[model samples]
Target: MDKFPIHIAFNFVFLRKKITGIRVHAIELFRALEEQKETKYIFHVITTKEGADILNEHGIRANGGIKVHIIASSFEKETDRLKLQLFSLNNTLKQNRIALLHCFDYLTPLQRPAYAKIIATIHDLIWLENPNTYSLPKRLFKKVFFSHSIRKADALIAVSKTSKESLIQHYGHGYDQKTTVIPNGLRNTFLTIKKQGNPERLIKGEYIIAVGRYLPHKNYERLIKAYAHCNTKAQLVIAGSDMDKSVDLQRLAQELGLNDKLLLLKNPTDAELISLISHASLFVMPSLTEGFGLPLLEAMSLSTPVLCSDIPVLKEVCENAALYFNPLSIEDMAAKITYALNSSPILQKLIENGHERVQAFSWENSAKQVMNLYDDLLLNY
Candidate 1:
């Protein structure tokens, strides 16, 4: 008998983990399905009402007669949370004859025993590498559960080669055969804003931009300190949500005497973010670690000159398209910021190269590759 076309159930167990990157991934996955008539596919976005609302706002609702499955699990403890996730997913799996189950969370495979292809995307390596990044008890539980999940997954996806290496080094004790390297893609808004170049939103080319949640790994402190010491001509506009409630970063900015220079615009809209990046003199990502820095690509796609930490993931993603700065060394960040502010010719060259580099990564391309993977699994399973 001829093989049946693959059907994917994208299990988003933790919808609040939703961010710009995940949104782009989902949209692209659906768009690719729409275009590929030979390879018939269906997407069951297993999320909550809030998650569905986010997708709807982004204009990715129920395309091609696809439906979003809203799953609810009322649990407060870590152990209970895992159990609920497993139970909810078990029900989802039994209800749908899904050929492949791809999940952003770790417990999808543990719950669904029926799927021929079980894949999980490991979006970050911090849980294994740096336990302190998470709460003590939560980290302990995650280490065990995440390790178990990886071993159980029929396939594991690492968003970047660095992320792949990190997974292998940390969790490849018995799951080496299951891992695959697939880079994340930037959203269409990135390309759209670049093409249209909305003048009203564009700055008069007087500021530098930094984007990311105010998390420790983002290293916003270093950026603020560096900006304080760097050339004074350009203001530093920091855009993103303050996911952490501490407001320690805000205090740090004030302490550095950068109160007037640092602009903290929290959780700006996509249009606002695009406008910020498109007009900035430079885009700085001082993140100490990332699975794949999507913001790096987003900024680069908008033809913004970028300066990121010289970490493996950022280097792999940005190549020579960005200026590299030492994440920990505030002095080095300061020096690079100074150079970027002072050298117009160098910055212009970086902008041009950035535009060229970003073209290589697209949501449609990523989704198509994922579909191909799904079809391959179904055919050869």
Candidate 2:
């Protein structure tokens, strides 16, 4: 029992709990870490009341190795943020005697106690890569804060090699040495596939499925156009959260004369998503950019064939388990989808490959990597 408490701060996602990824990553990571409790850990999670409430909504709370510290002020307000900087954040860190801190989602408080070492996860530089992601002022604000998080944190955690390269490309000043690549992972449930999935016939017949939030960079528009051009008879079903209602995918499908062919599913349950993916003719991810493609793994874990963009991050995650297409070209995407559907031998190989690929990732494995990082930081200290 080489146990000695090491305090680390985490909890950054202000999740609408939109999809499993956001909540699963934020809480499940810690849960995974806690399960690997042979190594000493006392997670001093500093989050807003709302953030704490969000965790509560998911039916989790403080456990033996997990300690929740509520920040009295709101993270969303400007004045309250300043107050967090000048008083709330510093006091919280000092009072906890936090030796190490882990910041998630590029959200970091600039102020910290002198003894506290910081580690921040660079999820994705999406705002910078994706145009029209934010207004000029908001972009400027992100630039100011994100740069600080990059420069200030003692160790940076990039979810993929692409993200690490992007960080260096933007903030190149020998920052790469301190940055470590630790990929996000799926829960254990994904690893074990149960055949009983589609209970309600929530979606009748076979469909090609895509799951992600409705973001411009996700390239849903191109996906829709590709499906319209696609020769396959299977319907195109895009399942995202209710938040995507603003994007009005229905209108795009209607314009493409795919109103009958395209189905938009809002906030499907875990069982439903698994059923949808497991039962799909193919699972497509047409994102222009991604930090890491967890959905690809989810789709794969269910023995579903995957056809996704040839982008670096997705490539890094999927390797040879899936088919690839140019996300920007509707013609290529359509051709790939149609070709994938008709190619029985290739699809069978993909399903077999998917079963093998998913075994490489798990929450427990991710936790062990993080614990190793924490142990190294302590030994060096």
Candidate 3:
């Protein structure tokens, strides 16, 4: 029998701004899938002009068997943009004969072609888990739309087991049956790129690094306070996109008398980030909650000792590879940072374990599992 043509359509309409975890997951996963010679599936990406431009900027071009479809739309208003994408997506999927539609972001189109199976990847349930991070209106919108999208999906992929459990707890036990845990993987660049010197000179001397957007869940203020309490000369480098929260963090740093010690790099490029993490004394993830901590793996791949919050998902991701600190306790965080910086034995052990832990996660493996899931779903139909 002739092999079936499995044309997978990935919806990237939600990616309008700077690159985030969700956008990275989609791009890296697609790239991995493209490299799979065993599975002859034609990949089609549906993204906005801005998203397409960003891909192009990263040298992610459509060639080989992969194709890119740009959807021109206005992003002035959230609701209006979503509406435009939904209407346009329905037409595009039909015209392109999309066999399966994968929504990289949590939400999916309310109306889709009947012939295509829809798969939605849920990175986190921040709105439901930590309501304080989002406004009431935005939370309500996500609750409604996300619930609908999950219910409509033919299958759901969770980035971590914590996320899958969260879905079951909030969305009910039915989700447990359909949801599969396929953790996110590092981009090939992160795995193969050589450690380059800090070209920007962002760090003066020994420094600790943390990466995340300026969100309350990221707990940057607490991380700063902990750093101030630690007696190390190492600087605290917080690198992420500057949302409005950065101003508040700067104010907090001043209040804590850590203005001189805290360095905020707003949205560093991938190469710059690699350089920063590669040379760091330690990489810390102070997030209160995460679906999966990708940076921990990135830091580990770089052979940087890891220190992170003692949260369930972090524990699941880091396993025995990192030194844990109580996220809510400044003293605990401080002590852990001090130990990680001063103790060479602990640091060396962590680096060794980190490299071993990181080997289990690869985009190639992740893509193969996703492709197998697609095949299983198609066979059932």
Candidate 4:
């Protein structure tokens, strides 16, 4: 009963140091799938030098059915002009003669080997939702890339049910059947059965925490503006990477005379994040749009009281475990945060509900679903 190795390429080319929901999804799912690492399935992970370190930590190496290929750069820029290589995947596809190419990011190669079946994980159709958040080039690239990949891909994995529906609604025709809703899962550390958090880098006193990179779609600016109006005395701590680069979040806080009350920690390590989340009085998710609100689930897992946007994705992830607010209305967000912090009964209920809600999501569960999808896709091929 000898079985041939099925070659599959994991497109981690675009992963950078900045921690986003996509990076978390890819790494966590892979970690869960790592338990089944053997010769039955060959994993060709194409990634950058930094990404390799993350993968290597999970007992992943080139010795087994896994082969790690480190590239110099994901994609070389030529004076802001887009290239056809599409994260340098086409050549890799052709050279490796890959049977199935799984794209963790939103993009797939514009040109790839004919035999290669593409399975792209679409996080969200945020570009279609918020045209102003992206520049003309990015918007155009996303529209073209999304359309081509959705139409061409053998199957698409949407991060949430809402994301799946968004694909069908906007992309239209031949999308609903192919797209599968596979929600992101939390790390074991966050589970109440395990440990809520590791005390790595401790920030003093109680604080209201929010985690996300400094991106326009993340809606940090509005959150900061809302924080100014809140009556709560809790420190506003934003543990996002590269906040100093993307937007002047600190200066915004300063303009509102919140210099002492606001703490902006850039690129906090995972242990630090766990400590922050576990100890926080409240965790706020003020995203204008998201495919799946991973942070909301993470907060719930850590037993932190959740105050987030009333967006469908956030609701879908946290369910009734969170207090909701209008993402657009700064006043609503401020009021919600203040109320959540002040209300002991509600916050306690959220923490209790959080423990129960998080039981449904796990890396193991997500990995199982992914393996099932992989088996089905490979069976046809």
For model 2, residues 209-268, the per-residue Cα lDDT tens digits are 999877778888899989888777799998877535635678887787887898887888
Q: TM-score for each prediction? A: 0.90, 0.90, 0.94, 0.91
Sliding window of 10 residues with minimal summed lDDT for model 1: 72-81
Q: What is the C-alpha RMSD of each candidate to the true structure, in Å?
A: 2.9, 3.1, 2.3, 2.9
Q: What is the lDDT of residue 231 in candidate 2?
A: 78
Clashing pairs in 2: none
- Residue-level lDDT tens digits of model 3 in 228-318: 8899889899998864448888898899898888888888888889889988999999898888888898999888999999999999998
Candidate 1: where is the Cα deviation over 4 Å?
1-6, 17-20, 37-40, 63-65, 73-84, 202-205, 243-246
Decoy 1 TM-score against native: 0.90
Task: Evaluate model 2: give its lDDT.
Answer: 0.78
lDDT measured at residue 270 in model 1 versus the true structure, 0 to 100 = 80
lDDT of 3: 0.85
Task: Please give the lDDT score at residue 210 for candidate 3.
Answer: 97
Cα lDDT listed for each candidate: 0.73, 0.78, 0.85, 0.79
Q: State residue 193's C-alpha deviation in candidate 3, in Å.
A: 1.7
Task: In model 1, state the lDDT of residue 280.
Answer: 87
Model 3 deviation from the true structure expressed as Cα RMSD, one decimal place: 2.3
Residue-level lDDT tens digits of model 4 in 29-75: 87687775545788898876666776677455676667888764443
Top TM-score model:
3
